[model samples]
Target chain A: MLKVENINMSYGDLQVLWDVSFEVNEGEIVVLVGANGAGKSSILKTISGLQKVSSGKIKFDNDDLTIIDPAEIIKKGVVHVPEARRLFNEMTVEENLIMGSLHGEAKEKRNETIKKCYDLFPRLKERQKQAAGTLSGGEQQMVAVARGLMSLPKLLMLDEPSLGLAPVLVQDIFDIIKGIRQQGITVLLVEQNVQTTLKFCDRAYVLENGKITLEGTGKDLLNNEHVREAYLGI
Target chain B: MDLFLQSLVSGLLIGGLYAIIGIGMTLIMGVLKIINLAHGQILMVAMYITWVLWHTWGLDPYLSIFITIPLVFVFAEGLSKYLLHPLIEKDSILPENQVLMTVGIGMVLVELARSIFTSDYRSIQTSYTDKSLYIGNISLSLPLVIAFIIAIILTVGLFYLLAKTDLGRSIRATAQDKFSATLMGISAAKITILTYGLGSALDAAAGSLLLPVYYLYPDVGPLFTVKAFVITILGGLGSTVGAIAGGLVLGIAETFGATYISSGYRDATGLVIFLIVLVFFPGGLKRFTKV
Candidate 1:
């Protein structure tokens, strides 16, 4: 489980995230939906230890995350699949996956993990020898996902995986996220595609202007007028 | 015919040394995007280090590689961490600004070498000097041959390291995208320092090898540095293998230019090729690897 309490993030004098709080139970998919600049990505970044929170605490299990280094935070089973699919463009799809598995697990398990990733995204296996930069948008997204899986994180935090992806591919990506949860990895997803996200997530939060506007069960949020009007376009 | 052939052989032999040094220049530039103007000065410093190791400790210049390369690597790392690293870290240091920094560093190094070592030409003569083996009508000097062999080995070895190993992969990644490398848990600060150190160490190796072949002087690096610049730009900025080929081409051009044209301005011929490449082919020659 993960806990974020009263986290405040800022850039110079501009506050990005103000007193934001959220949580994820073990093996559950919790999504944060927001428009651009709503601080959905910022939340993921703060939890991943990339951004310095001005105040408050981020907890993984029972341990305080502020003191841990980003690399060590990842090793402690919190892997972040960054937005824009920042793959090692010059490297093969396989090599990029290997790099993700750099810090955690044994060599043998790493291989097994690669095979599992390949099973999940067979396109990556087919293009194992190809450079990641050349992959199609959907395939590149798969590599990015499969790469994050290499670390075998207890909680996988994905930042805008569906960005720039087509609507059909967006469904496929969300289905993959469902499969990842089935594999027993808890996910904290940030998404702009609100309708699909609510359908897939068990619980959800709508972030508005760096503040949590509402929180409820997936079904409740789907039927809520503000959520329906603002996000779902009902 | 003998004159042409003689220059050709000697050209190939010395070309190896240029390739070795050029690879270092290219490597550092590729990662840091800093044109190391003082690159030649580092070679001069290495030459001085080799000379000191030879005179004080009574070690052969060739045998002193173990001490020279590592020391240079450490020195280069420390130098970047303290001096150049700060400027590079600021993110304002572009390729053009880096050229200035390198030149500034080179001036300091050259002046330092000038003050301590003096400008007097120094050479370490061994029993093998002038000892050349003759096969058919061709004559091969031992030291020149050794320089070629060492250059080839180091160039090939570095290319392999950069292209094959995980650390090398990390370096390449840092070279292309610093932020993305960090996302993968690779440290840019650490990589830059190591890359600077590795590049400086290569300069040390070349300086030590060339110490006997050429006289060691504070200002000696400028000539070779110019040659290195031409070689790197002509071959390709980021390609190690390109540097090697560029070195060989420059070497052959200089030798043949000296033979067919004029020996005094052999460097001019190399410069001319540089200008042509600049005018027509801006990318130089990229040794692109298939992933």
Candidate 2:
């Protein structure tokens, strides 16, 4: 489980996150739904140690994440698949996956994990030798997710995994997220595709202007008047 | 015909050594995204180390490689760790502080060498320094031939490390995308330090290889630093394969220019080629080869 307690984040003089707070229970897919610039990505970044918080704490299974080095954070089973699928563009597809499992147990089981990743994304195996930049948008997203899996993460944080993906590929990505949950890996997802994400997530939180404004079970949020009007557009 | 063949042979041979020098700068540039202005100065320090070993210990310049590489690696590692690495965190107004820091490092190194060595041109005398092997009307300098072989071996060894090894992969990964690499648990700071050290180690190798035939002075670092810079640009910013080609092209071009256009214009010839590449190829040989 992960707990984010009243974290305030800022870049230089401009405050982006104002005492934001949220949590994710074990073995559940938690979705953070918000408009553009609502600080969804900022929350994920602060949790991953890529960005520092001005106040409050981020705890993953009771480990103080604020002081941990960004590189060391991943070793504690918090693998963040960042927004836009920032794969090593010049490296081969397989090389990108190899980069994922570079520390500790993941490194030791590298070969097996790579095999598992290839099985999960057979298209990637076929294009294993090709440069990652040359892959299609959908395939690149798959590579990013598969790369996250290669780290053998107990809790995976996905930041807009479906951004820029086509509608058909978007469905495939959502299916993969469901499958990931079935494997008992907890997921923290930030999404712009609110309707589809709301239907599947165990719980959903509405992030508005850097603060958590609403939280409820998936069904409760689906019928909420404010959620339907702003996000679902019904 | 004979003169052309002779110069061509010598150029290619020396180019092998130049490739090692270029590769070092290229690696540092690729990973750190900063032009290491101190590259040649570090090489100069290594040459001085090699010279000291030869003068005081009677060790062959080639044999001193075992000593010079580790010494230079640690030295450069410390230089970057203590001086350059800290600049990354400083909220300086000028973003070019890291590159400027290298310039300061170079100046200090040159001054240090001058105070101790007194600017006297130093060359090591070995049995093979002046000897050459003949084939019909063309001859090869024995020292150069040996250095060329060593250069080739080092090049091949480096290729293996970059292509097949885990450290090499991490280095290349860091070079391609520092943020993503860190997200994968790679300490980009550690990689930057290691890369600076490794790059200088290669420079040390080139310096040792040059010592038997080349003269060394306190300010000799700038000349090769410029050469490394030209080659890195000529090879396209951070491409490894391009560095080798760039070195060879510059070497052959300089020799050909010396032979045909006049020896005084040899350095100018390389500059001319560099400008032409800048105007035409722009991306260096990597634009053509896609390496």
Candidate 3:
């Protein structure tokens, strides 16, 4: 559904993403894993049209994603649930979800969608009126995911969805990712949590210092000794 | 007793106009998080447009709103795109750079007005400027009363726009956090332009009211700038409702002070509130302390 080819990105003289490339097939969960400053998030940013690439082309659903604005990208049914669960702190969870439908209103089915989101995360429905800032870390992540889904996208790229969560909450988030895949939305996930990401994702890529160092099935990488040592820190 | 009732009624009438002007300050501050020191000068500029529409075309000042509002919106849009957007984009106006730049813009706009229109005060004295209606002991100038009503309508209309629309959601998103807003598919530049246009529209309405009650010059805007700055700080920078309340409070207090105290220091209410907000309610009537 999406393709990125040889994207080079830099901030002034410091290169952040060098000759990075990746792809997301329809309804597939592709995990991009790496250590800090490894350009995994940069790839997601490039795909979402938020970060400028020094050189490359990004094609999504047969459209040039690189040439468009972030709004346009989302309107094209490619929504990005950014890292840090950047829900508008002052807005209610409902409002945050409403913000997701910026391209146009899905008014006729809004109630149904809200119900679907509630079924996915009952905790969120209970606290719908609460300010997003006041939610627990896991609950806020749910709001972020729900908000991203509000766009009714064919693909959702999530950056570090399990970041800063407890072990139980992290497990719960992984389960939700599986549930999202069941709903038929393609996902490109970026994460530093190796074992969970490898277990959760089908096809995975390892990024190291702005380059793709490894690519294979989650099982292959799990059994690979070098991956275990450097990534799983075993 | 009658004089007091009269004063109170008159104070409320002008209070409404102050609310209109103060909302412009709040609207600009909300999305951009900067005081538009040039705001008052923009108001003066709009007032001149109203004057021209009245004097040149024989259109009533109130009747000219249909044109003036959109004109002001486009004018502010151009200014935001060409001037404010670039500075905001470059991240050039940090805490250290903001005051000098905003005040500098204020001065430039004022001088631009002066050079173009000269320092002479202008009055759009339509035939009805001084006509009044007396209901019981309260005598109200028809223009002043109409200005107040229109100002109220503009304020409520703007509040509705800010609170009830998709564009408003994007604006609120941008105002709260730029990065998050972008992540949510909002273009910060577009929101800023829309916000500036809305702010300028409020300023135009305020200027429309000023047409009948006040004489306008390049210098007229500075006094308004002072009042707007004070009102915005008192109300909390981003709260349109706060701006309305703060403006009315300042208006009534100043009106009473001018009558009972020294008229020389009448307008000191705004300055006094500015200092009070700085020293006391620094977070503004509520806590803008970001916590």
Candidate 4:
């Protein structure tokens, strides 16, 4: 489980996140839906220790994550697949995965975990020797997710995994997310594909202008009046 | 034809030593994204250490390498950790404050060596220092041939470490994307320290290898610093394979210039090739290898 309470973040004088608060229960796929510049990515970056927060606390399983080093946060089983996939462009697909398990227990079980990742994305296995940058958008997304899995995360945070993928590829990525949930890892996803993400998530929150505007069960939020009007356009 | 053959063979031999020096600069540049201006100064310090062991303890230059390399590694790691890494966090007006800081460090190191050694030209005199091997009309300098073999062994070892180790993967990952590497649980700070240290150790090898033939003076550091940078640019910045090629190209060019053109223009040869590479193959040899 993860808890982010009343967190405020800023870049120099420009504040981005204001009093943002959220939680994810164990094994739940929690989705944070927002428009561009709604601070969804900022929230994830803060939790992952990539960005400093002005106020409030981020706790994963009752341990304070805000003050720790980013690498230490990853050791606490919080693996973040950041925006744009951020794969090591020159590295082979397999080397990128190997990097995911660079420290601690994950390193000891790296071979087994890599085998599991290849099973989840067989296409990656076929292209393991190829440079990650050379892969298609869909395959690169798979590599990103599989790389996150290599860390054996307790809470996996993904930012815009389906951002630039085709509609058919987007569906496949969501299916993989569902498969990941079935494997019992809690996922906190920030996505722009609101309708599909809402349909897939267990609980969802709509973030606007750096604050949560609405929270409900996935089906309820999908059918909500303002959600349907502004996001779904129905 | 004989002169050309002789120069070519001699150039290749000396190029092996230059490759070691270039590899050190390339590794540091790759991981830290800064030109360590103090690089040749660090090599200067290592040479002094080698000289001290030789002068006082009567140890061979080759025998002193095992001691000097690790000593320089620790020294460089401390410099990176306590000096360079701290500058990264401090807010500064100049984006190249780290690079500027290396220039200051180099000055301090050169001054320190000067105060102790007094800028006198010193060379190690071993039993094989002036020995040579002959094949028909061409001859190979014994010290250079030995240094070349050692350089090849060290280079192969370095490539193995980079390609086949956990620490190496973390280092490459950090070089590629510092943020993603940290997210994967790699301590970027630690990797930077290790990389600086490793780079310094390679410089140690180069310093020791060159001592038997090259003269050592406090002012020698700037000359080598320029040579290392030229090789880095000529090979393409941060590419190990490119550094090797750059080293050979520079070595051959300098030898041929001395033999065929004019001895006074030997040092200018590397500069001329560096300019050509800058204009034509801006990415260095990495563009060709695509590595």
**TM-score of each predicted structure versus truth:** 0.93, 0.98, 0.93, 0.98
TM-score: the better of candidates 1 and 4 = 4
Instruction: Report the C-alpha lDDT of model 3 over B165-220, residue by residue, as the tens digit.
Output: 87888888898888778877788889988888888888888887778888988898
DockQ of every candidate structure? 0.47, 0.83, 0.66, 0.87
Candidate closer to the true structure by DockQ (higher is better), 1 or 3: 3
How many backbone clashes are present in model 3?
0
The 10-residue segment with the lowest total lDDT in model 1 chain B:
B282-291
Q: What share of the true interface contacts does each candidate keep?
A: 0.18, 0.82, 0.61, 0.91
Cα lDDT of model 4 by residue, B152-243, tens digit: 99999999998899888888888989988988888899999899999989999999888998899998888889989988988889889999
In the range A108-196, model 3's lDDT, one tens digit per residue, is: 56667888888999998899988999999999999999998888888988899999999999999889989999999898899988898
Model 3 CA deviation exceeding 4 Å by range: A104-111, B1-9, B91-105, B126-128, B131-141, B287-291
lDDT of 2 by residue, B87-159 (tens): 9889999999999999999999999999999999999998779999999989999999998998899889999
The Cα error of candidate 2 at residue B25, in Å, is 0.5
Q: What are the runs in model 4 whose C-alpha is more than 4 Å off?
A: none
lDDT of 2 by residue, A1-234 (tens): 899999999999999999888899999999999999999999988988989999999999979898899989989999999999999998899989988988899999999999988887899999999999999999999999999998999999999999999999999999999999898899999999999999999999999998899999888999999999998888
- In candidate 2, list every pair of residues with a backbone clash: none
**Which candidate number would show the highest DockQ if scored against the true structure?**
4
Ranking by lDDT: 2, 4, 1, 3
